[model samples]
Target: MPRVPRPAVVAAAALALGTLAIAPATGDGPAVTDPRVVTHFDLTRGQSPENIALAPDGSADLTLSNARQVVNVTRQGRTRLIATLPEVANPHTPVVGAAVVLGIARAQDGTLFVTYATGTAETGVWRIPARGGKPRQIAQLPPAGFPNGLALDERRGVLYAADSVLGTVWRVPRAGGAPTAWATGAALEPRNPRPAAKVGANGLRFHRGAVWVSNTNAGTLLRIPVREDGSAGAIGTRATGLYAIDDFGFVDRHRDTALAALTGGSEVELVRPDGTHRVVLTPGDGLSNATSVAVRGRTAYVTSAAYFTRRDPNLLLARVHQRDRD
Candidate 1:
């Protein structure tokens, strides 16, 4: 991969995503008494870390949305670059300028899958080796879509990606092949039509026999049943009012509870099966533009991307004791 200039690419992504201003969180909300800072990455490493995948040993594989690199953070807080992606070239409009790397997932055997977009016309999902090796293009998304989040069903050998711009979820083979639309509906699109509002389906996760996804622009959580034939069934709403909900993790599968990172709201919310939620962490607790959450045991790892704002990005950990028993 080529060493793309950071300053220019970061600026171009910020502009394209409409994440130029990240306001400081204010007002009163239920916040974690004291969240622990697990790790911190300055501009030197990358900016706007979007998603995280945990290795078998609990190390974190992070996708830098602005820097176009996959970095590994050890349980002890050490960071190392695993791979750098090529600069995204937009064939559509000059407004997009460049593409940024976003979602990531690790396979059982340690292979990594990543999603990136140069424009809606050119989006890619690539596969990279566990240690560090050449990246191979696994799938190319259809035109007029931006692939953001990725989830893999290792047992079924299926990979799913969420497109933020097209409001669609795609299915592909784990070994790299053509992608097909798995699910599509109005619930995945942004509610507001403002051009600056870059929102849609943001995160993809496979949980409890269903494929779950979060809609950032609509502030809704939805799930699609994975049919026995390996196709998607009807889409159902799991929760709503989760404003700016990005990536999230299940806290208790049996209880159907999850911790969602509300990026636009600048807080981490504990969502219930009934569509109700409560703030678990805020900027007061050091969360700035919280993007993704990964749970290991009882500890939840949240990424504060800060996005295009002045606030720097870092990772935070919080011990989440179930508020109410199932």
Candidate 2:
């Protein structure tokens, strides 16, 4: 999602990088036990972790949206450079208005796939070798469209990318070729006329037998069933009232519940299938502005871009308690 400037906050997110700290839960929600910042990124260098892809070896690959870089972080909080995208020739572009890397996904072989929403011909999905090298653009999307979220279905060798501005889900082959519009509807269109809040379909994922998408402006989560032929079936709303949700990951293998990042609200919520939800982390828990959530078993990894707070952009780790139920 594009960085939409916001008002400042009072207290900034605390806890030194690589140190452990616990923050009491705000509101009436349950306490998030043992939440700590794994890494404190340099805001001046635009090292904001926008999206996360978990590696098989337990490392997290992140897309530094504004910096146009992909980085890898080990479980011990060690960060390493993966690859950086091309520099933007012009600052002013249509749609999102600026060049930024939004979403990322990793293949089974360690290859990394990312989306670069540049308002130029260079805008598209790029592939980076696992060992690291010059990144290659595999799919080309419309320059006017902001491709914010990406998901790779390895079984089908297809990548699903959500274009926030175009309100379309594009299907691209992993091998590289032309892209096709997989799904499009008003449910994925931006209704908010505000310059900063005009994003739609901000996060995407492939789970079970369907593709799940988050409509940022509409505050809804949609599920599009994948037919036997690998085509999209009728679209359905799985949840609503998820204001400012950017990215999320299923907490359980059944896919009945999820840990969603509420970016503008600066919190992570435990959302259920019936649309009921509860805050699990907040600004008090070292979250400047939660951007994306990646869940691995009982451990949850969350990224805070600090786009609004403009303070400590960091990565947080928390344990997802399974005993609590709605």
Candidate 3:
């Protein structure tokens, strides 16, 4: 079961103070202190959208975890079902509908790569065509591995996936080849002592010659150097104390800053290169269990899965606008 932390009274007061202090600006851009939800889409119950990939045409493709489907949301807010994955038997539990489709990424050529886990020993990555067709298995991960997040290096034709259960990262060629264990260490392991904590390395991204990963259970953001041969070098910590950091997106490429979706914490954290961070949005701002973020220009497309919440079980896809500061 997913853990949800109760909002602290003192912390809530501090957030209100922080938000007020950041208000009122003397700049060229609009005066802004917090992110606001511009619009949202309400999905059916149990869709449980996990990750999203932005298309070149300004559309967004999302992975429906519990529904086991891929959907394309057009720029005009039209949603189209792309594909439905075949059901696989769960090996971890006897639950009837536990299999899930998790991470997704679109290559430069428009081909989509997705990761699916059946709560079983058989988990793998599959490739789908640009216009949506039958999914072809590209590579299968090791037994007992639970792949969660995917990152692609389109220039190098390489794809990386994070194995949450195994606390490892796997790499595979985009042209269909064997998956190799790229990196492994204790830093990727889950730090929470709770037996129900399942995630370790939850999200993976390739940025500026490094592979960045988020550990949901450890509340850490780590950077793994990429060698010339595409192999991983020594791992380094970029930020910590980020609770339930799920999937994040780069906010400022030049500054090496990112916005992370803290699922259990019900907040989106803006993390800097120096480990400094602050909440940019929260449940009070209509971000209940925000799971993933896809940034385009100054707007962030955030998904609220509300996985373990009873308050709002509907899946929401919302936009948060950020103003430029002079």
Q: Highest lDDT: give the candidate number.
A: 2
Please give the RMSD of candidate 2 to the true structure: 6.3
Off by over 4 Å in 3: 1-45, 90-97, 120-122, 193-195, 311-326
Clashing pairs in 2: none
By TM-score, rank the candidates, best first.
2, 1, 3
TM-score result, candidate 1: 0.86
Residue-wise C-alpha lDDT for candidate 1, range 1-326, written one tens digit per residue: 01123453343344335422222333332234459777776766556688989887878899887688888987777888899887645444112335678899899889999987666544678899978787778788865667888999988998899987788898889988888888999977755454334467888898878899998766778989999998888999888767667899887556567788987656888776666677778888888778898887766788888764437688887776655554
Report, for every candidate in turn, its global Cα lDDT versus the true structure: 0.75, 0.80, 0.71
lDDT measured at residue 107 in model 3 versus the true structure, 0 to 100: 89
Least accurate stretch of 10 residues (summed lDDT) in model 1? 20-29
Specify the poorest-scoring 10-residue window by lDDT in model 2. 7-16
Return the lDDT, model 1, position 23: 28
Cα RMSD, each candidate: 5.7, 6.3, 5.8
Structure candidate 1, residue pairs in collision: none
Candidate 3 local lDDT, 72-106, one digit each (tens) = 87756677889887767644521112667788989
Model 2, residue 237: C-alpha shift (Å): 1.0
Q: What's model 2's lDDT at 202?
A: 79
